[model samples]
Target: MAVKLRPAGILLAAAGALAIAMPVLLLLPGGGGAVPRAAPVPAPIGAGTMPVLARVYERPLFGASEPVEAPADAPRLVGIVGRLNIDAVALVKASDGTTRTLAIGESVDGWSLASLAIDAAFFTRGAERVRVPLPIEPGGSEAGTEETGR
Candidate 1:
């Protein structure tokens, strides 16, 4: 007795094979059809608008003090650009050195003291909502330029 392959099964197998080959075909270069290494690809940002990191004052939320290292679409970008800084000012007279006081932004203050729920933003799903802690300092000035984390 010989096993007869059904047409539906054959079609399904063909479909599966095609589905698997789709990526391979796409990766193949036009000329020699060479398959290169699969590198990480970031999703496209909004049209005419890219992801911007929110930054206020001297410190940046997504990058170091360096100007070029900062990331765009950061929460600090929103706060600074929007100029929406909401927090109280605490003045304390210290007997230490000069009259230098430590002032933190509302978001930073909230996060540091466990006042607000602050979690590292993860881009596993998508760039829907990337919450970043606002600047920490009473009169944090705005810094121009934005950067995006790759």
Candidate 2:
């Protein structure tokens, strides 16, 4: 019996041989150094700080709206009357000088209290969520003395 190779078989055999030789070729001397590693790890833009993403996700089905920017006359968060709970209320003084205590999910005027933290309260109007920080008292403390969650 005589051995015979078809075009497809020969091409396949050549491909297999090359595939097997690749690792060996890479291991051989004079191969390029370290295969040039995928474009160095990418250095952070600022002092080891990764860029924060500011994009807001909107869920149309859930009636979720995009975060809205607080207007210039937005009410100022004066203080947190309670801890983070159902009973926790945010003391907000509006532009008209009327102060109100608002619990979570409560709305005053057109602003709805969305969340409350230790030093700040978030209000939502339409698709916008605005964060109001507690104002510093004149005798309270220096501005830069405390960390503001930068």
Candidate 3:
């Protein structure tokens, strides 16, 4: 019997030879193989060195100190619609004798409405705050009483 080689057989032999040699070549020394290394550890921060985000978290979102009394020239609270603190609206009489409607955080005549209650509205200007009471009628009822039913 005579041995014969075909294109397909030659290609199969070449592939098998390469497959067997690859692992032996990789295992040889100085073959530029990857070496396992320990992971790097991070250093601890010093007490004097605070991150920017840490400094921001240390400050208060709103001013926490007690506010001074408001000035006499501040606007007067006329009436308040709605009793809830979050959704209440305050009517104020400005120094110029004009009526203005304000909500929490709204500004009138340089004063910002900081909070609201059923009978009072608080306004703030810088470090000063004023508690403007709701107007009272002659019948001993607060203003807007008929509307709010309180």
Candidate 4:
């Protein structure tokens, strides 16, 4: 008779074969149009048009700063703000801390991400969020033709 298998049962069958191979090692860097997307019911970046704020704007005018410039796999800083720009995800801290979100795609100089409606009191903890109130003609604004999110 024989029965042999240990190393914590071969590392518990190699950690259950790597926990069901963790979504194939996270979709193996998705190359064929990155799978798992199916939320279509008349929505693909429209209904008003706006989307671009990968994060980094509690205050950043002209020189810009902060730990912003997300998408390093983006956990949440999916970006967009208007009322000029005030949603680093509405300072994301809900469930009790009372923060909010709804600025989908606010564009002005994002070159045409086209969406704007930001205003969580314009986030002024130390100021410098924006100001171009009717005076800007360098590239001549066409990213949504200024509804006022620039």
> Could you tell me the lDDT of residue 12 within candidate 3?
99
The residue pairs in collision within model 4 are 49-114, 50-105, 50-114, 50-115, 51-105, 53-79, 53-80, 82-118, 105-115, 106-115
List the candidate 2 regions with Cα displacement exceeding 4 Å.
1-70, 139-150
Q: Tens-digit lDDT track for model 2 on 1-150?
A: 998889999999999999999888888886645665577776657846643444333234453266444578677887887557756888888778898888887887788998898878888899987777777768788565866775
Candidate 1 wrongly placed segments (more than 4 Å): 31-150
Error of 2 at 64 (Å): 22
Q: By lDDT, who's the top model here?
A: 3
lDDT of each: 0.39, 0.77, 0.81, 0.40
lDDT of 1 by residue, 1-150 (tens): 999999999999999999988888777777336658898987677645744444344356674465332234322312221111344232222223222222243222112211222222111113333334444444554344345579
Model 4 local distance difference test score: 0.40
Candidates in order, TM-scores: namely 0.23, 0.46, 0.46, 0.17
Q: What is the lDDT of candidate 3?
A: 0.81
Model 4, span 2-109: residue lDDT tens: 998777889889989988888677777663356777977886667465534544344467544543343222122223344354433222322244434534343222
Q: How high a TM-score does candidate 4 get? A: 0.17
What TM-score would you give candidate 2 relative to the actual structure?
A: 0.46
